[model samples]
Structures are given as structure tokens and as C-alpha cells.
Target chain A: MIEVKDLHFAYGSNPHDTLRGLTFHIDDGEVFGFLGPSGAGKSTTQKILIGILNRYRGTVSVNGLNLQNLNSDFYESIGVAFETPNLYTKFTALENLEFFAQFYGSGTRDPMQLLTAVGLEEDAHTRVRNFSKGMKVRLNFCRSLLNNPKLIFLDEPTAGLDPVNLRKLEALILKEKSRGSTICITTHDMHVADTLCDRVAFIVDGEIRLIDSPRELKLQHGERFLDLEYRDGTSLICTSISMDKLGTNEIFQKILYKYHIETIHSREASLEDVFVKTTGRSLQ
Target chain B: MRLLAALKQDILFQFRHGFYYVYAVLTVLYIITLRLLPETLVYPTLTIILFTDICTLGFTFIGAIVLLERGQNLTESLFVTPLRLHEYLLAKILSFLLLSFASAFFVMLGASVGGHDRMWFVYGAIFSALIYTLFGLVFAARARHVNDYFVKSLGIGLAISLPILAYLRLFDTPLFYVFPTRATLILLDVLDHDYALSEKLFSVASLFIWFLVLSGWVYQRFDKYVRHPA
Candidate 1:
């Protein structure tokens, strides 16, 4: 749904560039996560993709149209949820959505339906200035979906939300996924990136370090070992064995023959562990 | 349709926040101040002060709104939408201009009720308010500090006008003819006194031309002054 090739951007008057020859593409109907630490050009990439920042040194096309050539109609097909809550604080949640809804050619979702989608229906009439950070985040999410966009860009979608609201957001994203919307999310949260993303890209210092499905990356970098726990008379004893030699090894056979096999487990690397190993930097 | 909705929302937001009410009171008080002037004074001088005050108030409020939006990063957020920089700026200017015109109309309506010749007041108010508001936008776009714009607008307005007001005593002073106070002076010279209608027509045309030129400058450089989502 979106493609970036050799993308380069520098803040004018600044000495250094923010994005350096970055290339990536998000396919239709998939949740593509751009995982990186702070200052890794995540927001800049999203900004460029959403057509907010122009004057870049590379080509970016969304839905097959060149970025520079698209007009106001281009915005109608895409929804964007910025990392920061950028609502008009003086307006009620309903008013804010209604105001923005007028800018799109597509029919807008009912304001109540949008509020309910973000779990803010009860607070629809309250002024945004009175909302907590989580509440504002939810409202921002609702605003993004008001146009029923075919593509959605969510920047740190779950930031500042309570666990329940965070789960609600994850479910909403999945719901959008089911409805065939391409989503691109930029976040440092590996757990979210791991669970929600079908394919994830590890970006560091304006470069794509790796891009693959989480399962594939984890398997490629993980150790091949089995963890075994046997019941000792009053307790359980645990030991590790290589997966390759488990059947032919005499020690494993003896443990199985002489004691109760209490439990067995296999080990695999997590996205966070792979990220640290690849970048030599913690996600923190 | 969308642009109008956005414009209406902005105007409603202004009203909801009590700026509309505050401006209404200031506008009323200004008209009353004009009426309370000594009757011996002519109509033209009274109208000049009233219109100038109306224009100043409009400029100040519009500048404040723009500066507040800049400080809060509201403009940056709006830019992310389909809104062009020019559309936003035009909406703000037009909304303020219309509101200022309405204020001026009501003030002049009071003057009309008192049997004053308000035709000049109506024409002069529009010419003065539009010019001053456009001037205010130019400063508000580049002015980093709101207090600074406030100080600068008053300082510039007074510095330029005080000399002409002083020269009004010397009816033949060349400086009086070259300055905006000249416009006010010519109006004052004919207040209770009668002047040819041709003279009023000439000054009115001059003021209208001044307004048009200033508005043209505003429209030309408005895109450059938008600050690019900073």
C-alpha cells in the first residue's frame, strides 16, 4: 500500500539528515511495524508517508500514486493517528471529530460510533482540556478513523493508555486488519510489535537493520534446546538438553525411566532479544 | 462547503471562548465614548476616532488569536489535514474583517440615530479596519512575542499619527497632508463646518486605494508568512 525507496530527508538549516537511504514497503491488509529506538527516523518516515513533510530526496508512493503528485483527494483514503494528542482542547470530542469529518469526500462515521470505537462515547460531550492523557489518546484514535480510511498510520497507538484500553486498541487494529486496511505503526514497544505486526522492520540510525516476520526472525536467531523438569521425590529438578541428541542420549533416557516427567519446554528468542543482539542497543 | 464549515467553526469557537462578548462590550463602549464628545466638535473628527479605535481593537484581537494558535502548535496540527496554508490564513483574515465591519456598523448605527452624518463613518471604518488588520497580520506572522506585537502596533501607530495630529494645528503644514492624520484632519476640518462633497469623495477614494494596496500585500505574501508548520 505504501513504498519508500532510498528515502532521505534533512530538516532544512540543520547540519545532519534524519533519514538516510531508507527503503521499505507495506503490503495491503497487513500490519507493518517499524520498530526503532527514539530518534531513529520513525516519526519522520511516518510524516513523509502521510504527506505532511515534503521536499525529500527520494521517491515515496502511496496506493500507487507518487507522493508529490497527490492532492487533497489522497488524504481521503488514509487515516493518521499521530503520536502526540493534537486535538483542539477547547472543543468537545464530538465537535473535534465533526469539524475534521467535513474535510473528507467519503461519508463520515457517525460521531457516536467513532467515540464508541475508541471507548470515549461516555465522554463525548466533555471538553478535551478536561481529558486525561489516555482519554485524549482514545479521542485521537477516533478522529483518525472517522473517514473509514483504507490505509491507517498509527504512531505509538497504545501510548498513554491503560492496559484495558491498550487491549481495546489492539483489538480495534485487528478489526481494521480484518476489514482489509493496511496499517503502519511506529513504536519501540516490542511486545506490541511482536503481537500485532504480521511483518516487522528493525530500524536503527535511519537504516533498516532487518525485516521479517517475527516468527521467522525469532526462529533464525533462537537456540535449539529443550528444557526438562523431572520429579524428584519431594521436588522437581530441571535440566537443559540439546534438541538434536535428546533421543540417543543415555542421560535423557535414564531421567525419563527413573522419574516422573513433570514438564518439558522449548526455548526461542523474543523480538526484543533479537533486536538487542542485532543493534547492540536496548529497545529502552 | 468544507471551507465555510471550518470558518464557521472557528468563529463559533471564538464566540464560545468569550472573545466575541468582550469585543462586543469594547465596541459598545467605544461608540458611547464617541457620542459623549462635546457637540461643538465636528462629525468627521469624531468618526475618525471611533473608526480608528474599532480598527485597532479588531487588529489586536486577530493578532492575539493568531499568536495563541502559533504558541499552542494548533496551526501545525491543522496543516496535516487537507487545509492549505493560504486557505487557513484567508479564513482568519476574512472572519476578523467581517466581525470588525459588523462592529463598525453598529457603532455608526448609533451615530445615525443621533442625527449625525454616518455615511462617512461607514466608509472610513471599513477602509481603516481592513488596512489595520492586514498590517496586524504582517506583524503577527513574524512577531515572536505577543506582547511585542501589542507594543509595536501601538508604538508604530502613535509615532506615525502623533506628528500629524500635532501638525493639525498648522492648517498649512506639508506634513499634515502626507500622513494618515491628514485623512482625519480633512475629516475634522469639515465636521460642524461644511466642506465641498467633492473633497470627501477624493479622501474616501484615497483611503480605499490605501486599503486595497495593503490588502494586496497581505494576499501576496500570506503563504510565505505561514511559518511552514513550525
Candidate 2:
């Protein structure tokens, strides 16, 4: 759904490029995450893809059209939720959605339904200025879904939300995936990336250090042993054993047959660990 | 159809913002003040009030709205939508024009001013308001905050309207005709007299030309701001 090659952007005559020869493609219906620290060109790259920022030095094609050549019709097929809540503070939640929905010619979902989906049904009539940060974030996400867009760009979509709302939002995003929508999210939240993304690109200083699925990356970078915890009288014993040939190993069989095992967990690397190892920098 | 929808939305938003209410109260106050003026002073007083409120104040109102939208990041979001720049600009101009006309009409009605061409008065007020509103867009586009906008708008308002005051014989100079405000002042001047066709045509032509030039400049500046905002 999106293709970018050799993309280079510098803000207003700055000698350093914000995005340096970045190349990546997002498949249709895939949830692609651009993972990076703050000011790591993640938002800039998303902005270019969404047609908000032009004058870059490379080809960016969304839905098969060059970003520079696309017009207002381009917006009809895509939706964007910016990092900051760019909402009308004075307007009610429903009013803000309705006002923006008028700009789309057709295929707009009902504003109230979207609000309800985000658990904002009760605050539909409340002015946005009175909403908390989490409420505004939910409303912002709701606004992006108004057009029922084919491609969605969400920047830090789960920021400032409590666990319940976060889970609700993640479910809604998964629902969008089920509907075959192409979703691209830019965030530093590793857990969100691991849970929601089909593939993630670890970016630092405008460069992609690594790109792979979270599961695949973890498996590749994780230790090859499993840690076993067992109870022995009043003490707990923890031991590690390699996975290879464990079925026929006498020590593993004897431990399992003789002692009660409390927990056995594989020493798998997390997405955050892989990201820090690969990029040589933290996601923060 | 989209333009109309956007226009409706903008108008509704402005009403909810209490812009119309505040202007309504001020319009009534101006009308009451005009009503107490002596019969001999009523015509010039009406002209002055319309010029100040509709023309000068219209600029400030448009500037404030634009700056407020910028602060709220509305302009950034609007830029990504299907709304064209000209449609957005026209919606703002037309909405403000309607409010300014209402103010002018109520002031005229309350003052009971007679012996003037009503159509000419309406046209003058609209053209003046358009010119000033366009000027406001230019200033608002460059301003970073309300205080910056206020300072710049004050300077621009003074520079433009000072010529109108001079043409009204607050100060004497034929040189004042060189400014665009001359066209508006001449339109107001023709209201109280049975002016010659040539003089009326000249004022209309001048105001139309000013409108075209100012609209072009405003659109160019506004488009640049939308594409590459500082």
C-alpha cells in the first residue's frame, strides 16, 4: 500500500537530513510499526507518507501514486491521527467529528458510533477543552476512523491512555487489521509495537537499523536455553538447560521425575531487548 | 457543496465562539450612539462608524480567528483535507462579510440616515471589509501569537484606515487618493450627493482592482504558509 525509496528530508536548509536514504514498503492490510526514540524521524517519515510534508528528496508512493502528484483525493483513501491531539478545544466531541466528516464526500462512519467504539459515548457532548489527555487521545483516534480509510497512520496512538482504554484501542486496531486496512504506527512503546505490529522497523538517527517481525526478532536474538524453577523442601532451586536433545537427557528427566517444578520459562529476548541490541540505543 | 458545508461549519463555530454575540452588542451600542447624534452630523457619523467597525474591526476579527485556528492546529489538519485554499479563504471572507453587513445595516436603520443610495452603501461596506480581511490574512499568516498579531494588525490597520480618515477631511490632502482606502472613501462620499457617473465608475473600478490585487497577495501568502509553515 505504501512504498518509499531513498527518502531524504531536511527541515528548512538544515545541513543534516532528518531522514537519510530510508527505504521501506508496507504491504496491504499489514500493521507496520516505525519504532524509534523521540526525534528519530519516525513522525517525519509518517508525515511524508501521509502527504503532510512535501519537498523531500526521494520517491514516496502511497496506493501507487507519487506523493507529490497526489491531490485532495489522496486524503479520501487514508486517515491520519497525529501525535498531538489536534482537536478543536471549544467544540464538543461529536461536533468536532461531524465538522471534519463533512470534508469527506462519502464512506464516512457515523461519528457517534466511532465515539462509542472508543468508549467516549458519554462524553460525546462535552467540550474537548474539558476532556483529559486520555479522552482527547481517544477522540483523536476516533476522528481518524471517521472516513473508514483504507490506509491509517497513527502516531503514538496509545499515548496517555489507561490500561483498559489501551486494551480497547488495541482491539479496535486489530479489528481494523481484520478488515484489511493497512495500518502504520510510529511510536517508541515497545509493548505496543510487539503486540500490534506485524513487522517493525527499528530506526535511529533517520536510519533503519533493523526490520523484522517482533516474534522472529526475539527468537533470533534470544538465548537458546530454558530456565527451570523447582521447589526442594524449604528452598527454591533454579537451573538452566539447553533445549537441544532435552527429551532424551537423563538430568532433565530425573529433575522432572524427582522434584516438583514450579515454573519453566524459555529465556527469550523481548522486542525491547532486540531493539536496544540492534540499534545500540534505547527506544526511549 | 463542500464549500458550502465548510462555510456552514465555520459560521457555526464562530457563533459558538461568541463572536456574533459580542459583535451584536457592539453594533447595538454604535446604533444607539448614532441615534443621539445631531441630524447634521448623522451622515458622516454613520460613515465613520461603518468604516471603523466593518472595515477596520473586520480585519482584526479575521486576524484573531486565523491566529486562534493556528494555535489550535486546525489549519494543519485542514490542509490535509479535501478543502481547497480558495474555498477556505472564501468561506472566511463571506462569513465575515455577512456579519459586517448586518452591523452596517442596523447602524443605518437606527440612525435613520436618508438621501443615500442603499446599494452603494452596502457595496462599499462589503468591498472595504473584503480588502481589510484579506490584509488580515496576510498579517495573521506571519504572526506567531496573538500578541504578535495584535501589534502587527494595529500597525496595518492604522496605515490603511488613516487614509480614509484623511479623505473624510479630518485632514486635507488630494494625495490621499493614491491609497486604496481612497476607493472606499469615495464610495462613501458618493452616498450623500448626486455624483457624476464618471466619479462613481472610477471609485467602483478602483475598489474592484484593489480587491483583485489584495486577494491575489493574500492567497499566495496563505498558500505558502499552508504548504511550508514556520
The model with the greatest TM-score is 2
Tens digits of per-residue lDDT for model 1 on A99-218? Answer: 888877768889899788878889999999999999988988887888888899999998999999999999999999999999899999997898899999888888888899999988
Interface quality of candidate 2 as DockQ: 0.59
Interface RMSD of 1: 2.6
lDDT of 1 by residue, B55-162 (tens): 557667877877766665565556656666556766776777777777766765665433354566456555666666777877777666789778767776665455
**Which 10-residue window of candidate 1 chain B scores lowest in summed lDDT?**
B221-230
For B14-106, candidate 2 gives per-residue lDDT tens digits of 887889998889888987887888877777777777778877788888888888888888887777777788888899889888888787777
Candidate 2 — which residues are off by over 4 angstroms? B168-175, B193-196, B227-230
Q: Which parts of model 1 have CA positions greater than 4 angstroms off?
A: A228-231, A245-265, B41-54, B70-72, B111-124, B139-230
True contacts kept of 1: 0.25
Output the number of the lDDT-best candidate: 2
The window of 10 residues in a row where model 1 chain A has the poorest summed lDDT is A68-77
Per-model TM-score (chain A alone): 0.93, 0.98
